[model samples]
Target: IARIAWLSMGLPLEVAATTVDSQCGSSQQATSLGAAMVASGMEDVVMCCGVEMMTRVPLGSNMKDGVPMGESYMQHYQPTSQFMGAAMIAEEYQITRADVDAFGLKSQQNAIRAWEENRFEREIVPIEAPVLDDKGQPTGETRVIARDEGLRATTLESLAKLEPVPGQSIHTAGTSSQVSDGASVVI
Candidate 1:
């Protein structure tokens, strides 16, 4: 992402580039690092950018080699979860399934309204997204996507009807974070 932005913006190659990963906090970490550089007088201006192509990379790719839950850690701790951990936390906090679903419904509705009102027009950069057909094969066509692909027309009733993973509570696809593909840049 940094390289593409550098070349596209006609920046010289001498400028240094660094990428940081803090899982869900990656973009925030990038921005914080950039700010630290500027604040410490090590740099005048720094560009921070983040990109996650979930369609290509998907989730849990980093866990292919297994999570680094060492023997001592595993002995004391339950197996770590990704999304399920959040669901567990919500349940522990006594947050009901209906509450989560209602929040999801409100979020989707707000996102839809934002797009309809053109609130994202200024910040969104159009991307040439792959055009996939029914079988998930590329159709040799590309579409300029300016809005989020994961926003769905949802309602409280619809969200309420979805089931959580078997034996789990308070979490379903409708109440969970949607899979998304997106990139953003800042200077």
Candidate 2:
């Protein structure tokens, strides 16, 4: 997918492209690799890019066999639990549910405000997306999509109403991050 995306961008075929999966840090890792390439004089300039189409492949899809625990790993560590890890961190840091909810509220508010102020216009690359009919054939119509589709108008009260993850603390769908689809590129 990364190679295909590079070609689709009209880059020269000789330019190397590869995907790096570091979970949520994929893009940051890609950018770091690009910077290293430039610093090492491997290339004049390099593009750092990453993307996740969460709509097609949801989060944790790659963890079907669990997080690849080995005997050596188990000897030194317990398998990481996403929820418990977050809960423990929150507890250790003395962050309360209200604090989390407040932060989530701020995020929601800021996103909406940014959209209204056209702050995202500076970075968003508009795409011409086909309008499809019910049967899935294109209707020959197209729309320009320039903004994220994940932002929602949320309140503290609304966030508080969400249920926590079954086994551990504080995080709810409202307070946690959203699953989204997007591609980003940096040169």
The best candidate by lDDT is 2
lDDT of 2 at 103: 93
TM-score of every candidate relative to the true structure: 0.80, 0.76
- In order, candidate lDDTs are 0.79, 0.82
Error of 2 at 141 (Å): 8.7
| Segments of candidate 2 deviating more than 4 angstroms | 8-10, 58-81, 128-144
Model 2 has an lDDT value of: 0.82
The CA lDDT at 28 in model 1 is: 83
Clashing pairs in 1: none
State residue 16's C-alpha deviation in candidate 1, in Å: 0.9
Q: In candidate 1, which residue ranges exceed 4 Å CA deviation?
A: 1-10, 58-79
lDDT by residue for model 1 (1-187), tens: 6676677788888888877766557678899999999999999988888876555543544234555767899989997566578777887888888888888888899989999999999999887878999876999999998777788997888888898865687778887776676667788
Q: What lDDT score is found at residue 183 in candidate 2?
A: 75
Residues 64-175 of candidate 2: C-alpha lDDT, one tens digit per residue: 5544666889999987766778899999999888999999899889989989999978778999988879764899999998888778888888888888877766898888
Q: Tell how far residue 97 is off in model 2, in angstroms.
A: 0.9
